[model samples]
Target: IIGCSIAFNLAKLGAKNVVLLEKEKMTGMGSTAKCSGGIRQQFISPANILLSIESIKIFKNWQDEFPYPVQYALDFRQAGYLFLLHSKSQIENFQKQMALQKKLGVVTVGFVNTHEISTALPYLNISGIVAGVFCASDGVADPASCCAEYEKQAKMMGVQFLTDVKVSDIGANGTTRRKIEVVFTNKGSMLTPCVINAAGPHAAQIGKMLNIEIPIICHRHQTIATPPIKWMKKNDPFVIDYDDYAGQEFYFRPEAGNENTGYQLLLGGHEDGKIQIADPDKYKEKIDQDFILYLADRAMNRFKEGENIQILTKSGIAGLYESTPDALPILGKTEEVEGFILANGFSGHGFMHSPIIGKIIAEIALSGRSSFDITGLGLDNFKTNTRPPAEKAIV
Candidate 1:
């Protein structure tokens, strides 16, 4: 999605030539295809909140913006995100985050007591939850479909996509030293002044090729799906509980398949003390049993209906996250390399913020400036040893 969106926007904005290269056979076959597709603006940090707000606006009007009735239907829902707070400390933390969000014009976020949560969601067992934070505009969508839409538009606008191709080297002509003169791929070489490293979990490898260190590593995040249930609440939100054992996360969203399937859920969360993998292409793709049991046990404890949550399918997806130290993305051109824009390291929020970042990257690739002010959120900040606020909400 990142590569396609960047190329799409660049072509849309009248770039003379644009090309996207993908090692995988299909577009979005990387982390984007495996994403759970949650979109929210209830972020704690300033850059995240600002970027998410703008991205959600684009998602809200995505269908109308494209208007390809057959090829561009966005299966998006505004069901919101309900963060289940388990303690006074968590509530206090949410209050602080909520205040910051409101200050940043996110008035849709509000706090509701645990007692009120029962009234809103009678199915949820709220004994452990002390309070809740909810945002109506925060929602979910089909990211793989969105990626295909961007690829289609970009291709129509004359952006060439070379699939099953590997980037071997990235270097600038020694004479100029200001632009990426050519890109060496497995198939052949291409000359381009600009190159975007949107390689997802394999982004670090790309940086290594350019002799620039992108502080991102691949970590496996697994997910599971449950069988269809007969009963469900109206307008049920994606619920996340952060105070479970081992700081374990349990997040699930409503996913409906065919009519016979009734109502189902797509659930997953991060396990405590995750290890970084050296390679995204070689890591385990199967979901582990221990993590599955951990998530299902928490689900059954939190909701009465969760006891009936049977494994709908044996298949599950384990996506690799291109994580950073601060859990924030690295954007903009770096001092180490000129004309080589770093658009990787989104940790796990890449899909949700793809819309705005595409625009920002488009602006940067064209005129060397971002439309949205993200100077503090760039690699430059890290170069100065700035201690930016850590993003707490990643579930």
Candidate 2:
């Protein structure tokens, strides 16, 4: 979404020579389609929260801006994201984060005691739940549709897309200085002055082509959908349980049309940490049963609907959740390379922040800096041991 959107916005900014290359036969065939599509402003960092807040405005008013049907229904139930806390320390931490979020103009989040949590979600078993942070503005959407809309808009804006073409290498030229000369691809080479490494999971390999090492690894996260249930039709809010034993887990609104009939469920427990594939060409798609069961058990304890839910589909795909040393994303430029921009590492928050990322990347590519300050996301932060800590609320 970021790549195509950036290409589209660049054209809008009067850039005549913009092109997008997709290794797959179609755009968004990678992680964008597989995303859990949760959009939230309840983040630990001010930058993330601000981006999310701005993106929500775009998503809500998508139809008015774009010609084609972006299918702009956020289905955004302000029903809130309930995060259960089991420890006193965790509760205090959440309280601090809530205060920070509020200070940054994200006033939709707050700490709720076990009694309030049970009141909000009566079906929940709050035996071990001590406190919960509820963010009413946090919601979900259809990632596939959003990606398609971005591609459609880009195409309409005259951004040429080359699909089924793999970028083999990127050549640089200059005597003392450096400039991207040509992009060697499977079909042929293309001469371009600038390139964005929005290759998703394959970002590291793309960076390696230019002799730059990007700290990005691919992880397999599995999600399942359940057959329709009567009780779930009552409009259950997207629930997340963070009990000490429960760890991190999340469940969101169903797919756009299937919300009443069935709902999509996601569970992330890549116990193997992350599998590093040396070659991006060699990728695997397989779901782990043990991981699914672990997530199922966690969900069943809190949401009664999960207890008797019948699995309708089970599949897994390889997506890049680029992890920094501290698990936050590594955005901005690298010192080793100029004219080569990096927008790769998003951890799992890429899809939700796609709009903001697209605009920021386009701004950087066009104006050398984003209107919103991105100084905290520079690649140097990782090397200097000042990487921002991972947001505890994300699952």
| Most TM-score-accurate candidate | 1
Candidate 2 local lDDT, 282-383, one digit each (tens): 655555566566656766765666567655545444454555544456676667667888887776788878877888888888889888777768776767
lDDT (CA) per prediction: 0.82, 0.70
lDDT of 1 at 82: 90
Q: Model 2, stretches more than 4 Å misplaced?
A: 64-78, 244-253, 256-283, 305-307, 313-318, 384-392
Give the lowest summed-lDDT range of ten residues in model 2.
Answer: 269-278
Error of model 1, residue 228, in angstroms: 1.3
Q: Write model 1 residue lDDT over 1-395, tens digit each, in one string.
A: 89888988898789967889998788999999789888888888888899889998889888554524438556778889999887888888889999999999888899888777888878788877778999988898889888998899888888899999999998775544556788998999988877888898988888888777888878888888876765553247888877744566888877766555556778888777654464776887888787777778877987787777787547577888888888888888877667899898888899999988888999998999987987666776787877368787777
TM-score of 1: 0.95
Q: Model 2: how far is 132 from its true place, Å?
A: 1.4
TM-score of each: 0.95, 0.89
Return the clash pairs for model 2, or none: none
Compared with the true structure, the alpha-carbon lDDT of candidate 1 equals: 0.82
Off by over 4 Å in 1: 67-70, 175-178, 244-246, 258-261, 274-278
